[model samples]
Target chain A: MFDLSTPQRQSKKVIALYAFKSLRGFIFFFVFAAFGMRGFLEGLAFTGLVLFVAATSLIGPVIQYLFFKFHIEQDEFILNKGWLFKEKKAVPLERIQSVNLEQNLLQRILKVYSVQIETAGSKEKELEIKALDESAALSLKQALLDISNQREEQEKTEVTEPEKKTVNPTSNEVSSTLLKLSFLDLFKVGMTQNHLRSGGVAIGLVVGSYFKFQDVIKQFFGDYLDGWEWENLMSFASLGMLFSFLLIFLVFSIVVSLITVFSNYYGFKAVVYQSHLELSMGLIKRQEIRVPIEKIQSLEFRTNPLRQWLGYSTAYIYQAQSDANKASKVSIPACKKEHIKILQETAFKDSVVDATIDIPCNGFSYMRLASYIMLATLIPTLVPLAYFGDYNWVVPMLIPAVVIVFWSYMYGSNSGIVTDKGFIGFKKGWLFKSFSISPVFKAQAVEKWDSIFIRRREEMHVKFHTASGSNGLRYFKKDAVNHLLNYINNTVIKSNRNWM
Target chain B: MTNEQILTHSLPDIESFSFEKHPKRFLNKKLIANTLYMIPLAIAVGFLFYNFSEFPWLGWSGLGLWAFILLFSLFVNYKEYFVRGYTLREHDITYRKGWIFHHQITVPFNRIQHTEINHGPIDRLFNLCELEIYTAGGSSSDLSISGLDPKDAQNLKSFVAGKTSTHV
Candidate 1:
């Protein structure tokens, strides 16, 4: 066991980790100075400047490693850092949400691991220990979790029976493996990723980097490249060459998608403990994530057409989050139906399995489809009319118009709600289907929106807000919406279970 | 559970609650703030009219548009004051605002993370304050109720704080 009461520094290997981090930051500056200022500085002077900068950067990490210290004091976790401007932070033990361990290639080679401590809310600054041996990291995590569990039990005892303080058995150390992916499953996961989205992102990155490179060239050789137009250069390419270029770009994007999927999800495994779940994965940068079962607000299962055909869906576990941008979500890829069933059972017990009543959005769905059609065709119809000043241009645009109408109709018809006594679920999307389920007791707020038109038509939109996110149902009958809202409100008010 | 338990008729309905309107002095404060904002734009148009003799139509039209906007906004503010209301129930508080696109949100006291009372210079002049209630459900779900008496805001804050503690 590691002593956590006294202030302790990270493993000595952290010095090397900090030096490499600083070197990565300075690499770009060094390259730019070497090439951009070659005509202005002598070779000897340039070498001396580089040596001095490198030496100073290395020394900064040593000082940082020497000053950083952390320890557990009373019921708070305290961290002290900085040599000149000392900073101190103390987070209450009960406020800690999760402790994760991560190991990158460098840390693995050095036989060390980095630990990340996240508190309950996004407002709390996350704490990270640069390097720790395996035993030290595990002991630190165990100590923090034990203190948090003890405080929770104390609170419960105070509320129920103050005279008797019972000590429970240490069953938290016992865990069972829930799911593990084989090499074949990993390959299937890589193959079934959303290729179109990855391709769009790759294209965006290429375009962005091209523009940045152009700016750099203009800065360095502005006088040599005056009066040069990119349009003239692009006009020289033939149609055949353009087609082949597109083919190459498609191949490149597919390869990038495959690489990303394989590296991030290799050797994935999930284990269930008494009150939490642990997930470990990755090829080069391994991550171990712990999510407390009670903190989970919602569970989402999503799949595309190809994945659905292959009997695979991705599961996303959303926990209580104070900021939407920093939402804590753990995604498990290539989960079959059986795996999803087990996960759902763990998160929500039998509530989801008992959800049988289905409430489909039907009567007012036509109005939503009409609005979608109008919005989608507005730009396409206007651009042709404005450019040509003829009704004939709209003839060619009718093909795309029909496709949009069909897609909107499918979208409206596919969306619906499902509910039971203890859980409420929302199902949406036609091509990219998703089903999200949350316990009725986790609802934080309820919202009802009505427009003048919808109000006159006796229809409304309802949203159920949770700590993770919200689920919305649009164009529903007023009476049904009122019933659902009342049921949710009653459940939230009566249930004494903790929301987070 | 039986079907009778699922019947929602016996449950408390949010639509049936009676909402209370803001104090009348809050309307006066809104009008004063609106006029203060218009004064600077009015002076700028006047300055343009005096400096540019050749473009008299430009200055006159600018002044006309400015006056129209100011009058329109004052009318909207007055009408909107009547439409906005709030209600505090045993377990939750509901705030409803907006006229054309109406929306109502209800947040339970048990879910609130913290509360704050804000008193701006103009609000102080009117002896009013605003109460903000935050939850772990992000900024959009947080509630901000403006135009309240200082004592009432403090009482409301303490009541919510007490309720939250019991839940914890």
Candidate 2:
């Protein structure tokens, strides 16, 4: 057992990990030294700079590792670090949301794990132990969890009856493996991954790097680039070239998607304890995340047409919003329909299973489509009139107008709302569909909005705000909106359960 | 109650609540604040008019547009003052605002993370305070009730704090 009550530093190997991290920051300096410097004097200066970088990178991590110490005392987890400006943090045990373990390539090579202690507070306020052996990390996680549970029980007893102390039952808590992805399942997930998003990311990376490396390219081949004829090169480009280029991009994106899928979900597994769910995955940068069931504000399931046909979807578990990390939501990729059902049932025990979309916002859809079409038409018509002073450009703009109308129609038709006694769900999207479900009691606020036009049409928009985020129905009948608002409000007021 | 009963039960209608308007002096405060902004804008327009004296039509149109905007804003502020009202219920508080686009938000006391009473320089001069209620749902879901009497703000803050503690 790990003695967590006494202050301790991470494993000695953490110094090397820290050095590597700090050295990564000096990459720009290395690049500049390699390409920007010339002459013996400049070369000597570059050598000095390199020596300075090496010394600082080596010495900084040593100091950081030496100064860092953490221990649990009373009901607080205290951490002390920083060399020049001494810093200390003490987070109450009850406020800790989860204790995750992650192992990147470097850490894996060093045979050490990093522990991330997440609190219900802002992300910056959380704690991280850069390197700890597997057993040490596991024991520390358990110690923190056990103490937090004890603190909660103590608080409950104090609140209910000062004399009646409850015994901790964490030792006998049931743990079950919820889901595990097989090799074939992983392959299917990779094959059905969103290629479009991968393609967009790949293109973005290429464009961004091109701009980043533009100065370096100009320095090396400035004369050659200046003498080149860009107009002549464009004259040689044809429809066939464009088609071939598109095909290449498509193939590249699919490869990237497959690689990402294999690396991220290689050994995906989910395990659920009585109070929290744990997910561990990744081949290169292994990560394990744990979230208390109570803190989960909403659950979202997303799938494309292909994934839906393949009988799997990605589920996102949204907890209380941490100000520092907006993308703190945990996602489980390649969850079959049954898996999603199990997750939903686990997160919200009282929620109805397989609740269909009961309220369709068709009026809202029609209104959105109509307004989009009007805006599209108006923009094309007015822009050409203002710039060209003619209707000639409007002919070519008709193609985009038709595309917009079709997209808007599809989006509108696919959007809907699901309302049950204990749950509220919002479903939307055309090609990439997403459905999010949250308990009614989890709502922090309810908002009703009505523009003059919407009011004239006797329709309104209703939003349900949860701790994680907000979801709502748009362009619903006034009466329905009002009923939902009232229903949610009443449920929230009457329910004794905590939102988080 | 059964789930069916909970669904069918007639709860107090939020629409029927008789919302209370802010103090009449608060309207004067809003007008003064608007004037402070309008004065600088008017001066900028005047500077432009002087600089562009060669085009008499341009200066005249600029001045006309400024006048129209000034009048429009003043009218909107007045209308919005009436439309903006808040209703405190047994379990929740509702605030409605806007003239053209009506927005009403209801935050249950139990869901409130914390309550703060803010008294700015202008608010101090008017003996008014702004009661801000925050939730874990982030800033967008927070509620700020401005132009509240200082004593009333304190009472509401304490009441909300008490409610949040007990409910949780």
Candidate 3:
């Protein structure tokens, strides 16, 4: 009963979105053109140019949208577009990894959303319908998933038991909201944030811009500065001025973090459907992301010192499909502690503690790390100290060395753990700690490396590679690496779990 | 149960696993490739030595270091032929290589995204090819076992493909 020949176009709302995006891209050009214009003829020419550019941009999307059409074939989903180029691409339904629906404020207002189709065969989004009616988008996703599921069932040679519940693609079942961040939660996340890091970033930005500002000043007041003796400027570099500058920078960073957190995470909510987890956040854009439960690779529970003290931890669910343009690993930031446990339960569906094998960090490891750090810094500092012929330089060098040593000691003392039952679990982090749990069945590859340096200490570095990404523990005892590698490999070989 | 017995049954030792050595002629192929690469590098070093001949010891030491490195690499290449091997189990494959800094990589068939057979002009002359198995995460193959007879590589590829098709 399914007709495979007909092609369809996206909703007309995409035209406005595309035109708006194109107009936004011209802001820099407009600024530069306005700055360069001085005469009446030039202003007239600029106005004409703006009109011409706007017309061209507007016409492009209209023509492309008219030509763009997608069809659902028997075995593949085919998309054809581009009036001049006439491009056609067909993606096998079996290769389709995920279908994600996203909506911005404009899209929501227009009653349309974008559908991004990701395939495992390529890193990029294989297909994107820029705008579709909300119900249409959901139906498209459901149809694609159902087709894939049908193909999978057909490929299974063995006769298995029938599914307990048949999922209706067009069901009107509503999902329960798991967690939503209130204004107070956002405040906590902002307060418990790393103030020093953002402060350092602000300081770096100022320092970098200082040279450009100096160039501008030289252009304007070069002769004046040359004639004046500028020795007095060094007086402002005193310790008290430095401390106040740092305090101001810290305050500035705190303010920036609060503003950023509030704006980005405004109305943040996580919801659980039958087969997917939807995360909606952002104030201006109102970003919505759908992460399929099956595509999730690992669950990471992260807690910094302040968050630990505040009794809350951030959670991240790393998935297999990377976002179309931004290759960033998406994380659920500032999740409540109870929410973290619920997320783990939903993802793993089993007990967590029983599968853990904790590797205790001992004093010897700390001593080893300290010695390595000292030896690493000693050679670089010696030459500068000797050339300066002053012992004061050595003190400055030792400051960084001591801080590094202390950090190393802290990191070394923190225990590492790995466990495997239904899923593979690993825990790490000293100051900013995290526990990563990935399904054991999805273990793609396991590797062990024993470099000459590690070989001397009778240790090996082991890495566990999953579909999403790889994470590992370094400087473990050689036997431990061997054991971990064997366990993962054996499990992968013997288990009947379907990673796809 | 004794600890030894428990260890023997529970843990699959890397040393105990039987690994198939690559064809011996692969060493000749490696030497030719090395010589082709070293000729230009040696010429560049010689030109540098000629330009800075005023410091004769510098040139001599530079040449000595280059010669030492060339010889050491050749020896290591030869040694790797014996040590570098791959093993195919029921559902997974393992490739081991390197002498000083040893490494072993094991990849399950279900995790393999795809497999590729690659060969160069020299490799064709030697009737050898490389089998590269790629995973989902990255651009690079998870395991690339070079220096295989074309037929053998094809067989392995098909075997892996069959396993992956069934499992994935």
- Give the best candidate by TM-score: 2
* Model 3 regions lying over 4 Å from their true place: A1-6, A30-51, A103-112, A133-174, A199-235, A321-328, A353-357, A360-370, A383-388, B1-17, B38-44, B53-61, B75-79, B139-141, B166-168
lDDT of 2 by residue, A112-175 (tens): 9999988885647468899999999999998888878667667667775566564545632688
What tens-digit string does per-residue lDDT give for candidate 1 at A170-235? Answer: 777788888898988877877778777788898898889878677577777888788667887698
Model 2 lDDT, residue B97, Cα: 88
Q: Please, what are the lDDT tens digits per residue for candidate 3 over residues B1-168?
A: 111122222454644456788887798999878877788778877887899888888777878878998898898888777768887777778888887777888887877878999998889999999999988755432788899999999999999999899875
Clash pairs, model 2 backbone: none
Runs in model 2 deviating more than 4 A are: A43-47, A123-125, A153-173, A227-233, A350-353, A364-373, A376-395, B1-17, B39-44, B50-56
Residue A199 in candidate 2, Cα distance off native in Å: 1.8
Per-model DockQ against the true two-chain complex: 0.48, 0.49, 0.42
In candidate 3 the C-alpha lDDT for residue B21 amounts to: 82
Q: Candidate 3's residue-wise lDDT over A297-389, tens digit each?
A: 788888899988887777877766432423425567677656776787776665364344555444356657687878777878777778888
Error of 2 at A146 (Å): 1.2
Candidate 1 stretches greater than 4 Å from native: A43-48, A157-169, A211-230, A233-246, A324-327, A351-357, A362-398, B1-17, B32-75
* Residue pairs clashing, model 1: none
